[model samples]
Target chain A: MEFDLEFALETVGPLLMAFLQVTLVVTVAGSVVAALLGLIWAVCQRELPTPVRLPLSWVLDVIRMTPLPLQLLFAVAIFISFDGYRKFPDTDVETIGMILGVAVFAIHYSTYMAESYRAGIDSIRQGQWEAATALSLPRSRVWRAVIIPQALRATLPSLGNWAIAMFKDTPFLLVILVPEMVAKAKQLGGASYQYTEVFTVAGLIFLAASYPTAVLMRKLEKKLVY
Target chain B: MSDFFQAISDYSPYLWEGARVTLALSGGGAVVALVVAVVLGLCAISPVAVLRVGSRVIVEFFRGTSLVVQLFFLFYVFPLFGIDLPGMWCGIVGLGLNYGAYGSEVVRGSLNAVAKVQWESTTALSMSWPLAVRRVIWPQAWGLMLPGLNNLMVMLVKGTAVALLIGLHDLTYWVEVMRKDPEVGLWIAYGAGFLFYYLIALACSSGLRLLERRAQRRLGLAPSKTRTTRATAEAVA
Candidate 1:
């Protein structure tokens, strides 16, 4: 029950480096998926026909409302159940789990990304659309040349915010045993019975990564606002 | 399909009970978060430098870390310090403080959004600071804050799913328990859990939407930009 500073440091200090790699991998891979898929979602929500829009909207709403853990669980369960999954060699299963984890992370955050993009798009004046039309620009050209560039400036700050959020959230993959930093911390804590120190180190690691990034993000947001 | 039905029918009662616990935890956490948000939010904007800095540190520390770690810390680490509490309390407090840090920003943002003249007019009245804030600023800020707060409440409801790790028999836990049964498939179990969470969030958001409309009506800010202009007009005059 007592704090053991020396033991905790010795245990976590080495393991943190190993696990930090996993965390960074998931964050980078997931960010790519989220940034691309989220833009697609945002564009589709605005341009798709009513028949497509109505159901897609409802599906995104469900994803947004539900917890990520449940979604990740669903993904893991479904992914591993395939006959091909069993046939895959060693480490493949875990690799598949990591991929599914990224998919879930990307999918979940994309819903939010869509909302921010929509807000940015909406903030664009009605006059912009009319001007594009009066210029006889094709609809695609209007969106491409006229709209998306302006929308992106507004979206960058929010996208960066969600990236930071997704980075912190990568640890939730531990439920599926993705071997990220917190999972590593938990394993060390369980083995050594030094839950306080190990967990404190883990929290510090998260803050160290997130806090400075957030400060930079606020600065980025202010810069974008101008 | 038949097996899914059998699983649902078999676990329906347990699922209902777990859903009740989930709702209770989320509802309680939301209330706790709202109060903390108001206090800390006010503190963050207070004229006192120490109060502002103190609140900022607390808010950013909570915001920077993952909620799961916070829960783990409260549930696992706190007991070592002789501050042991039950799993349920840990869940409530952890969720409250983490989300409250977020909600405080919502509160501060909306408060700041209130016209600067309102604050000047309050100063002009020579009333106590609290009275001026309560009467002059809050009415305008409340409407703006509702949308952000409603969004936080939805996130909090989904956030309660972390309680499963701490061994609370919330909706997610019940779903997990059912999934362990050979008869209950994983899809059925986790799908039901997702649907339950979605429904609860939908209900809360719709309720908040109603409150938002009413607040806007009271402020006479609804039905477009004219009301904003009127407010600006008042500020000018």
Candidate 2:
């Protein structure tokens, strides 16, 4: 049977376009948060005293120990109940909900990335730190000039994959009825009674969007000259 | 007082049943993933142009989509085309296929890492292709792939939660069901769910860590992560 291209386009056109922004915005923002905090965590993990480090580990552990969706839900529920959020009064609950959803996901992933960064950090030689020391490079300069850039290069493939995951995870915001891609399809289906076409189109659209990156990942994985 | 105990005592049966479903999905999916990985892995490395291109595209297609989305597609959409199947089984199949594609990549990567010299050595030993594969190649390929397989197994366990989306009475689904009671208390509903997932994930990770340690011991491999960090950390410090 032939596909209904026009019907699929009309239904998905708006939803896909809007949700695409939401997904990209959330992913880019989340990646920014993850990179900054994860880098800080990785850097501090080495030089910090055990007292500060030990408690920080516990916080990271709790974040890691929980599921992302639960954390998302918890963050939304807590934030939506706060006095400032309540005082804003005119704020869109759904936007607030979505941002909190993305933030929680970012925080959760950041902790994991932090650990991954630590692994990447530790993988660097002990001699490099001594050389930086011998050069009398200031601590911040050493980290800025030398350490973090290399650490992040190693972290990129994972961080990129997680960003891809974060992009896909925008659909989970549908649990809170945010108008994400899946939610858009759900709304269209519920309104138009065409769940099959709507959801299928949504998936295909996402597949279309994601295909380029996945292919690029495979290609870059190859051609490792070193 | 007895509320926490009652909550536990009441849900133990449901929890056990949920655990069983989780195990069944993970076990079935890992087996399917392994088979799929081997086939796709072989095809991915095959000299035949069509096989190579066909396997890469198909693997990429599955890996790009969300597993839950795929699970929904299998459960909801296929039936529209008149392919009747149980939702749980669809979830099983989807999880298997989704992970299979990923496992295939890991498989290919691991197999590729085997030194080129081994094949020459095997050829010199006068072993046939299949024999060499069975003896020299498979063991080394397996040794390299085991850590990856271990990681994938942990994912498959976590992935079992997607079953909840397809209306499976997995732990997450049941917990949501149980929590529907206003008396279940939001904290209890969520805390229980969190605890269950954490325990399962912990169990799976520890099991994987054991397997990884075992693989490292048997094959005596140091994970590359160790050295890369050592070099960089020293360079900066």
lDDT of 2 by residue, A64-180 (tens): 655565566556555543554777679777677667866877887687678668866665688888999999999999888888777666666556555665666666665555666
Query: Compared with the true structure, what per-residue lDDT tens digits does model 1 show for residues B65-183?
Result: 88889999998888878899899899899989988888888888778888999898888889787897788788888898887788788888988888877888888778878777767
Q: Write the per-residue lDDT of candidate 2 for residues B1-237, one digit (tens) a residue.
A: 377557767878987787788778877887888888889987887658999999988887787766767776677667667886887688678878888887887777777778989989998999886787778877778756765665566556666766665667777666665665666655676677777767776777677667666666667776433312111111111
Least well predicted 10-residue stretch by lDDT in candidate 1 chain B: B228-237
Chain A, candidate 2, TM-score of 0.89
Error of 2 at B226 (Å): 5.4
Candidate 1 structure, TM-score to reference? 0.93
Residue A176 lDDT, candidate 2, scale 0-100? 53
